[model samples]
Target: MRLRKGLRVCLFCLAAVTVLIMAVACSPSSEGDTTTAAPPTVKQPILEQDPPSGETGELETESGTESGNTEEETANGNDELETPAGNRNGSAGQLYALTFEDMMKMDEALNHEMNYIAVDLSEMTQLTEDDKTYIIEYLQGFGAEIRDRTLDQLVEEENPDQSSPSLKGVLLRVDKVEINEDSAQIEGSKYRSGTGAIGVKITLKLQKGAWKLSDSEMTWIS
Candidate 1:
């Protein structure tokens, strides 16, 4: 009996030890485990952008957009194209202007060459004082004498005999003007000394409401 009792005590103690071993085996093995646990994360902040422009022009942005309008100058030095101012003197005024312009070479007196001007308009029945003034002013700057008179009004001859022939100044005259609707012709003569004389033919046309010199030819040279 005592042996059986001793065996039963030993069995109970063995069972208790086996149960304790099973509990220990079932528990997680934490020995020599070096894996680290993850840390807590913090929330990130959001940024705000500026509002776009509300005006009718261009939008201010980081990328690209062509926005403004560019203005260009017109013919008359203004923003818009405009018709040229009218000349109340009509085609006659234009004729006179072109005739004088032909005489005015736009060069200094000494820098200009002797050439036939336009036809004489002193006898023009339609000529105005303003037209004559324009003719005189425009004919300046050229090396010539502006005469509105006829050949009879000037010295008919200069030093009949060639005695050290000197420059007696140039005298240009144009008369015998024939005007039509679209085209006109004139005869001009230039006389400097007894030997210096030339005959010129000036032709003009009415173009775009403006009288322009069509052609100028030296008919005779002496």
Candidate 2:
């Protein structure tokens, strides 16, 4: 009976040790499984770089604004090109205003040229060749002075009938001037011999720094 009791005690001790070892092994596996199954812990915050809000909108707005400005500049440049080079200040009327001396010079030049044109004396059929030559030479020399004289003085000096030809030329009296960049319109009265004042419009062009008559028209004859 003592031997059996000792053997039973040894068996109990071995069973307890085996149970403890199994418990220890199962605890480790369970703990490992529990640890693995749980949600992961984040120590440092995860930061991902994202573009600033409205960045694309701001970029698009800036691009549109720049494009609009470029278009406006181009339009303005085209407008500038359309305007004439000399009219940038837009003071053409003032700049091209004629003076008294200029008018006198024009009158003198015109009378000189008209002297030749007036040589056709339609009513004076009895004039000899020598007489015609002498009269033309005399008129060419003193045409302006004689024309500048009063009509009464001219009538008394010539002492001819109404059929006799008068060498007096037309005198332009400028009333208005409209100047462009390189052209001008002169509105004037043209006083012709025997004919009363007539309205005339003369166009002038600038060439080589000088104003030259481009065209002329009689608007009205009174």
Candidate 3:
């Protein structure tokens, strides 16, 4: 009985050691089974850049749009400028006609006021041959012919009170003038002592940078 009791006690001790070893192996302490829960997942935040705002950004956008519009407008304007309605040649023709008309008017005024006015004949030296001849013919109609008259002769003829008063009163009065490239026509009335009114037409030719009377004729309507 004593030997059996001792054997039983040794068996009990061995069983306890085996149970402790099993518990330790199953508790995740074994090298092959030891795994720590993956370190608490740390989420990283994503960074994003935002667009610019406010008046400065708006101004930039507006400036770009305005620049584009200006370029387009400038292109359109250039197209219009490329063509002109009345070109240089047309304008020059009109100017020539206008110049001739002005010269005719000046000539008519000078002739109408011949007696009461003193014209500086030196100023006439620059006149075209056509203009000189027109003056001479006009003076001749007033009974004071100026054939081959120098500048001095014309001055003496036009001096106030030198010629007869009756003759001066019969001088031609210009009514209208019509000019063309080659010719100009002057219409006027001659006043005489008892003859009432006589219509006169003087035709002038453009020659040598001047206008000269080419023809002088008288016509009676009444």
**Alpha-carbon TM-score of each model against the true structure:** 0.44, 0.29, 0.26
Misplaced by over 4 Å in model 3 are 1-168, 194-196
Worst 10 residues of 3 by lDDT: 88-97
**Residue-level lDDT for 16 in candidate 1:** 100
Q: What tens digits encode model 3's per-residue C-alpha lDDT throughout 1-222?
A: 999999999999999999998887787544545475456789999899565678678989999999999999999998877632223222222222323233333334334433432122343343445444444444343443334433244435555344422233233345566878877776655432223446667677766655555776666532
lDDT of 2 by residue, 69-97 (tens): 99999999988876222321213222222
lDDT of 1 by residue, 94-191 (tens): 57666555534322251235442333455677867666666655555454555564444333344445554423455556656888988889777655
Question: What number of clashing residue pairs does each candidate have, in the order they appear?
Answer: 3, 0, 9
Question: Whole-model Cα lDDT per candidate?
Answer: 0.58, 0.52, 0.49
> Against the true structure, candidate 1 has what lDDT?
0.58
Question: Looking at model 2, which ten-residue stretch has the lowest summed lDDT?
Answer: 92-101
RMSD of each: 9.9, 18.5, 17.4
- Give candidate 3's TM-score: 0.26
Model 2 clash count equals 0
Runs in model 1 with CA error above 4 Å?
1-90, 100-122, 141-147, 156-167
